[model samples]
Target: MKPAIALPLLGLAPLLGASDLLVKALGIALVALPLLSLFGLLLPVLRRALSGHALWFGALLLAGVLVGLAQLLMQAFAFELHRALGPFLALLALPCLLLVAIEPAGPGAGLRQGLLFAACALLLGALRELLGHASLLAHGEWLGLGALHWQAAADGLPLFASAPGGLILLGLLLALVRLKP
Candidate 1:
């Protein structure tokens, strides 16, 4: 629920909305999805280290630090992506903080939530980038794999880049997911 609102809001970069397929392919999709998963992995540690309300407050701070570290790592290793993603990376800690504040520590709950989060982020990112930009996979050189570059022309609807458009797209997607087999 949090991510359904959060993912499209944060993923509005030109890199994501590139008109080229290769650029979209090598964009932040790799880094962005796993960061949430890593936060999930860290949640238990944060919970164990800080009991009571301290865990709630401390987890937010810790998640910010973790996201910052990830930003630094991306800057050091993948400078182009770090530059491309820019301030958007700061948004990654949001779900982590929310998760820590709201969810109880249950067996495999974090895992389930993390996987769902990753899947949703990936799907939302793809939809927002593809439909909004009129491109599928774009920019492989950012990942240092130039050989994988590819792009097809797309006229593209302009609205998917906008929040209202994303909300509509998300609504339709949610409806599709809820349909019974």
Candidate 2:
């Protein structure tokens, strides 16, 4: 599958997790981008050590290890952020594995995909926080930072904070991106 299409699909879990809070989204992006790029850079070295099914399994193992390490670091430095991520943190490995299995493997491809994912996560997170709660970075304290709440004049649409609503928004956003000129 094309990275453009595959990434958004595989990233649905993280997107939902991120959509609830901007700080969580930032954390997800910060952790994901580097880990993915590192995975891409190390792909060739792993390929040289294993082949066929072993390569696939080994790649997944490496991705899992990276994800685990990231989780540990998040837990250490940002415990609340790590707790907020929950299962979505583990699910991150799925996208990494997919990226590795896809064509045009390299640091550049990983970086491109990472940027795309980060943009989507941040946009969705900010929009949801704004629309659902009438605020932004309401949980900034999770990262030991002061909350950067932006209160709106009126009430927010509540739906944007939920999974179904996020899915709807994601569909609309993806549709907009895929539109022809």
Candidate 3:
């Protein structure tokens, strides 16, 4: 039998564990599951809107605005990593624009465009996290964040948080985005 089925038969809590891994898995399931579902529902509509190259361009511009707003909010909160958000947002833009750029002006293009932005965004986020962690290891601190010791063991590595499992969620989002139409 599958683990999900066997776990209950064994009288074990499916969520058993005190490790950060359990917490992170729970966090991703809680947050990303809904987001993925919503994206799936919204994909068709977004593809329709992105039918035209002009519309695609406009959407990219809007994504830029949204990313900017996200950064602005991060800054307003006095977040230590405010500067990093801009680069991450920019990284998101790549896949968003790629869908439009690669799109051929014809039928079914709408179906192809929906999750491109989200995939690009996730990939960029993962890359950012990895690069950030590497930088932290090299310098013993996150670059541009001064000497704020972002303890890797307890908190997380620089590229992404550990418990929350942001990278896994990111990977899932990318897979969802790349789904065959």
| TM-score against truth, every candidate | 0.70, 0.90, 0.34
lDDT winner: 2
> Cα RMSD for candidate 3?
14.6
**Count of backbone collisions within predicted model 1:** 9
Model 1 lDDT-worst window of ten: 13-22
Which is the winner by lDDT between candidate 1 and candidate 3? Answer: 1
For model 2, give the 10-residue run with minimal summed lDDT. 1-10
Model 1 over residues 33-113: C-alpha lDDT tens digits? 566566677778877788887987887787778778878888888888677566656766665665665556554554555
lDDT, candidate 1, at 53: 79
Query: Which residue ranges in model 1 land beyond 4 Å of their true spot?
Result: 1-29, 32-34, 105-107, 145-150
Scored by lDDT, model 2 comes in at 0.80
lDDT of each: 0.60, 0.80, 0.37
Candidate with the greatest TM-score versus the true structure:
2
TM-score preference between candidates 1 and 3, better one? 1
Candidate 3 clashing pairs? 24-163, 129-159
Tens-digit lDDT string for candidate 3 (18-131): 012322122222222233333334334566776666666665675565445545654665344343232433333333344344334443333333333323333444344343
Report the Cα RMSD per candidate.
4.8, 2.1, 14.6
Model 3 ranges with Cα > 4 A deviation: 1-43, 84-86, 98-181
